[model samples]
Target: MAPNKDNLFGSKKEASLVKSNQLDSTVKEILASEQMNRERKTARLRELRLEKEALQPPPEPKAKAKRKTTKAQE
Candidate 1:
């Protein structure tokens, strides 16, 4: 009987697919962590800004100007 041979591309394809999947998962995890950190920092900065605004005095209101009378108008 002739000797059975392994698939030329089958094993290679499976190994490549496994490596690709691992790489993809690692990249996704890293991106997720970065997103979380960015959101947390944004929230903290926003809170600090709000606190600062609360401690500051409000602006004074400006008075409305009176209109001048014209000679043409009796």
Candidate 2:
């Protein structure tokens, strides 16, 4: 007998539901590791940001000109 619409679509629907559940669990497992890595990267980024914020511009030095001393002038 040829498959009816319900048999075909029903199986497809069940399959998609099972696949979605599996995908959700897999995603949760992957997120565990990714969460740790993300936390570490975020902490490093925070430290770098704080370091950048703490930095100050250096003070400018004064420009000095050379003076010519002559005994005739004195």
- Top model number, TM-score: 1
- Candidate 1 residue lDDT tens string, 1-74: 44444354457678899999999999999999999999999999999999999999997898889999878966
Candidate 1: deviation at residue 4, Å? Answer: 6.6
Per-residue lDDT over 1-74 for candidate 2, one digit per residue giving the tens place of the 0 to 100 score = 68998776777778899999999999999999999999999999999988887796656797898899878864
Please report how far candidate 2 places residue 30 from its true position, in Å: 0.5
lDDT of every model, 2 decimals: 0.89, 0.89
Q: Which stretches of candidate 2 lie over 4 Å from their true place?
A: 1-25, 57-74
Among residues 3 or more apart in sequence or in different chains, the pairs in candidate 1 whose N, CA or C atoms overlap within 3 Å are none
- Where is the poorest 10-residue window by lDDT in model 2? 53-62
Clashing residue pairs in candidate 2 (N, C-alpha, C atoms within 3 angstroms): none
Q: Residue 8 in model 2: shift from native, Å?
A: 28
